[model samples]
Target: MTLEEYKKEFTEDDAVGWLEIDKEFDRLYPDQEPKHYAPPISYMLGGEYPLDGVSIYESKKQTDHFHFVTYGFSELYYNEEKVNGEFSKWGFELTFRLKPFEGDNGNPPSWAVALLQNIAKYVFSSGNWFEEFHFMPANGPIRLETDTDITALVFVNDPEIPKKQTPHGEVTFLQITGITSAEYESIKDNPGTAEELVNKLRENNPLLITDLNRK
Candidate 1:
């Protein structure tokens, strides 16, 4: 989903927040002019973002919450000068607080799950601005972790070859983490049912489950 669509679908108060980066770097060997290389990096607001915002004391004082980090990488190319190259990388880190809506009910709200999943999909999806990407979970399992309320997810993107050398190259690897114990058990108990759950979760929150199952 586009940034505008994301904003529209999830409100700032919906226990979800994210951070994004779009950057360009220049490489130079000697006295020659610097070539421009733009690499985009996007991230969702994770435990780090909130802590940086309200001070460590405030964030540490909080009891219940969730955190996630994701990264993406796109193809790169040298500018006309050939002195440098351009590579696109986008990523996001996110954090969510359950206190806002926890007391409302016993079971977690669909919106909460949807929001988290949506953001996850955006970070891991190949369709995004990245040619390839990887996700890493800070806490537990990568795919489905439902046993715990608070969890952390992370993603990273690294290209095998330099952008100038292989502008159209593909991503070699991707990693994701932060699965809950309950989620693990669910999958373990019901072998082939993981796909069904993934589909259901994606249907509810398209933002988080972008093409994860695709080879």
Candidate 2:
């Protein structure tokens, strides 16, 4: 929306951005209730987690996996000062798709929740943000203490959720996909290899679901 248009519709307690996100997800999932995780206190009040919350959905695209989308990375609430801005807080929120592991029994793993929180903590603390094809090392197994080869991450735009422009700004759903140690090293060996690796992964796994069993 243009600045003039925004001014014409502005409200002090307007939750335009937040409601837009919810409306998109509601369209996708219909009547399903997603599993949501959030810290007890709000981040503005110095809560432990940087994100306001994460909502997880069971997706059957390509394979059965849990889809995690974050909140609090953007200007979720209304603010006249930021009307019709180009981008939200950092212009994006993190998303992840993880294949169901053994013993999940239809329940999304807790580690996924913790992983998002750690990523948010890093961004909120270091004032750094991630973008398409950016890769990072987890320093250990992504699922710590577990015998897994997925120890790193690479980002890409979420295939399912398209970017949306709200009254506050535009928000991109940046998806985080886990990778193996060999894959991580290969990216490091060749500075721009992450995009290539992600392309290869998409050949067989279009959704880029992070499978702990992957090697």
Report the number of the highest-TM-score candidate. 2
Q: What is the C-alpha lDDT of each candidate?
A: 0.30, 0.87
Q: lDDT by residue for model 2 over 1-215, one digit each (tens)? A: 77777767767687767777788789778888999998899889978898888999888778878888888788888777777788888889888999988846667888888898999899989999888999899999898887899999999999888998877788988999999999999998995878899999999999999999987
lDDT of 1: 0.30
Per-prediction backbone clash count: 37, 0
For model 1, the superposed segments whose C-alpha errors exceed 4 Å read 1-169, 172-178, 209-215
**Which stretch of 10 consecutive residues in model 1 shows the poorest summed lDDT?**
49-58
Candidate 2: global Cα-lDDT? 0.87
lDDT of 1 by residue, 1-215 (tens): 34454456555453222111111111211232321211122234232111112100011112332222222232222222211123222322232223223333543333444444455455455444322222223344223343343243322221111222222222222223233445445655774665554445445433232222222
Return the number of clashes found in candidate 1.
37
Model 2 TM-score on a 0 to 1 scale: 0.93
lDDT of 2 at 88: 86
User: Quick one: best lDDT, which candidate?
Assistant: 2
**TM-score of each predicted structure versus truth:** 0.25, 0.93
